[model samples]
Target: MYELRDKDFIFIFTGPNGAGRKTVAQMSGETLGMKQVISYTTRAPRSAEFNGQDYHFVSRDVFTEAERNNEFIEVIEIDGNRYGVKERDVAQMIEKHGAIYLVLNRFGAEALKKLYGNKAVRIFIYADLKTIVKREEDRGDTPELIQRYTSHYDEEMAYKDQCEHIFENLDLAHTVFDLTKTLDDNYLHRNLVDKD
Candidate 1:
């Protein structure tokens, strides 16, 4: 029903805590000419996140004002913390470049699909739970990682099943190749074949 082409893609990524979604996102950012729009969050920065690099850390007041102005494409409160992705953020790219990319959670993914109508594309990056657990070990994930990942386990797998496309990334090289192949002209048929 959607008549748009591949260039109109907007990525919506979801996962349990340590599924390496960030790594895949960064790869897409670099190779796909897609900018990773920094999220606005009230949560404090973790060791891996540098100020302005991972997110635009803001006080509640700044976020509230922005929300009042109708700035966000999607906004949600999770675990008592607010997070938002500005609508202007995606519109700016689409207005000038004819396409835009958004990396977001499952909830935001569904929301964007609804808002954008035919303009959005969903790509779910997934890994085996055992592989994800090993990835966490390599990244030095603590008990916190285990807890958070466990919490979203069902939702994470569900996103993959429900999304327009899904990629399994247990092997880094294979994942890279798959993602690269994904951007090719032939990729659409591959997705169809996968469904069959």
Candidate 2:
């Protein structure tokens, strides 16, 4: 088996709503001093979202232009909006260290895995349905949006099936602890060691 190292390894975290992959990405980004490749999208900005930080809001025309220029590492249209990670953002981080990660939905990650082969680690994040409702509520999602997200939970859970490793996210510290433990083991699966 290929050894997983803190550096020179990319981790892909996938899971259903409230599964906390985004939370891991944010935490890992801070831990590694890595800049997130905030995606560009055609959707209207949410009340809490800002330009060039959470996401790079762009007109559909501009997004299309950028994609045509081959500026994106990966791009996809979802829910009638175009979203993508630019190639330059990914390249800069990777050029410095091989430890870079992309938090993607099912489609993007699947395609990337196919193209890149075994270079990336797939970490699936998941939680029970009750956890999902609370997590979404904690984010201040409205009753209606929460209900909609809840309804789609099945689709999200399906994403976990594709991952090689699975994590049940309970909180920020809990998830980080798991990741750090993985680091301690030199990134090998813990079955190689005895745990009481």
Which candidate gets the maximum TM-score versus the true structure?
1
Off by over 4 Å in 1: 1-7, 186-196
lDDT of 2 by residue, 1-196 (tens): 2333345556666677567777787785565444555678898886667898767899999999999998876788766888887767655766675566777777667765765567666777788999889878888999887886577578777877678777888877878667645643554333333243
Q: What's the residue-level lDDT of 196 in candidate 1?
A: 17
For model 2, the superposed segments whose C-alpha errors exceed 4 Å read: 1-7, 32-35, 183-196
Best by lDDT: 2
Which residue pairs clash in candidate 1?
72-87, 73-87
Q: Alpha-carbon error at 112 in model 1, in Å?
A: 0.7
CA RMSD per model (angstroms): 5.1, 5.0
Candidate 1 lDDT over residue span 117-160, tens digit each = 65676778777777777777776868676666567767768777
lDDT of each: 0.69, 0.70
